[model samples]
Target: MVKVLLLITSAVLIILSLLQSGKSEGFTGAFSGSKGLDLFSNSKERGAEKVISNLTLVTGVLYFALVIIAILGQ
Candidate 1:
């Protein structure tokens, strides 16, 4: 039930985090002050990156909340 959901949420968070590009130059393939250009190419790619970052943050929060709930339930 709750535990299963929590596990799934955690897995999703992990995957999302992995899928996201890192802030460092090595990961993004461009150094700082490049104006957010690299593999992203254009505004659409940047927007998609933002969306994924937001979703990763949200899912991370959810995962933490679920862990607390599971602990408190015990």
Candidate 2:
């Protein structure tokens, strides 16, 4: 049961992470400095973006907790 939950949680985490928008323009613009140091700029996450971001965060925490529980149960 623990293993199944772990797998599901991990899968959800991965999916949520992928669904999020990229903060930067990848290595090309950031390293090239072509975007004028806007890599860490304040890009507001609203609507679906905000929801997905929050879900990703929550799922990450849940996944970590599940991993610890599994380890301790062994």
Candidate 3:
């Protein structure tokens, strides 16, 4: 039960975190003609990025809490 929820949350966090774009470090975009982009320019994540990011953070916190509880309970 709780373990299932923990695994699901972990998977969701991993997926959501992967959906985010990296900062590019000012090199990839500079030479790849990918400027003026919110991750690649021309298109955005439709605001779901924030939601997913927040949820990922929350899930991460919950995962840690669950781990602590399980460890302490044993």
Candidate 4:
């Protein structure tokens, strides 16, 4: 059923998002205006980080598609 797929996709999305490593410079860095988290940095994801990031992206896309499908089916 569409509802089942929706639930699974949403859960996966949440898990994938949480599994990803933080790119931010933590709470202190935010208020301190630290340059540690350079937005234009050349950092790249490798191995599991890359995999998790990709999975998150794919799951996010799937989540949106399922949402639209559910709404349209109503």
Candidate 5:
């Protein structure tokens, strides 16, 4: 059961990570100091991005906990 859960958590983590928006542009923008770039934009996550971000965090914590549990269970 633990193995099955670990597999599912990993798959979900991959999918969620893929769904998130890239932050690399911000790094480049910071170095370039682009006029239109909002490198430190104050805009809040307002929709799917917000949900996905929260879900990713929760799943990440859960994944970590599960890994510990599996290791200790053995």
Candidate 6:
């Protein structure tokens, strides 16, 4: 049962991770606040981006918890 859960969590994580949009700003934007770029104009992720981002974070935490449980079970 734990193995099955681990597999499902991993698959979901992979899918959610892929669905997220790539940050085009790169390292340059990290050094300086993304103020000039129109591409980075949107300070917040709206719509599907926001949903996917939240889902990814939730699934990532679930995955970590599952891994710990599985390891401790063994």
Q: Of the candidates shown, which would achieve the greatest lDDT relative to the real structure?
A: 4
What's the best-to-worst order under lDDT?
4, 5, 6, 2, 1, 3
Candidate models: Cα lDDT each: 0.80, 0.87, 0.73, 0.89, 0.88, 0.87
- Spell out the clash pairs found in candidate 4: none
Report the Cα lDDT for residue 37, model 2.
50
Please, what are the lDDT tens digits per residue for candidate 1 over residues 1-74? 88999989989998998998755456354555654445545433468798898999899899999999999999
Model 5 lowest lDDT segment of ten: 34-43
Q: Which residue runs does candidate 3 get wrong by more than 4 Å?
A: 26-46
RMSD of each: 5.8, 2.2, 6.1, 1.6, 3.5, 4.6
User: How high is each candidate's TM-score?
Assistant: 0.70, 0.82, 0.59, 0.85, 0.74, 0.74
Model 3 clashing-pair count: 1
Query: Candidate 4 vs candidate 6: which has greater lDDT?
Result: 4
Of candidate 2, the 10-residue stretch with the lowest lDDT total is 33-42
Candidate 4 per-residue lDDT over residues 1-74, each given as its tens digit:
99999999988888899898889878788779886567887768999999998999999988899999999999
Residue 10, candidate 2: C-alpha displacement in angstroms: 0.8
Best by TM-score: 4
Model 2 regions more than 4 Å off: 35-41
Model 1 spans > 4 angstroms off: 26-45
Per-residue lDDT for 73 in model 2? 98
Report the lDDT tens digits of candidate 6 across residue range 1-74.
99999999999999999998876566687668763355635558899999999999999999999999999999
Candidate 5, which segments miss by more than 4 Å at Cα? Answer: 26-43
- Please state the error at residue 45 of candidate 5 in Å: 1.3
lDDT (Cα, tens digit) per residue for candidate 3, span 1-74: 77787788788878878877664546666677765335545444447776776777887898899888777877
Q: In angstroms, how far off is 17's CA in candidate 6?
A: 0.7
Q: Is candidate 4 or candidate 6 better by TM-score?
A: 4
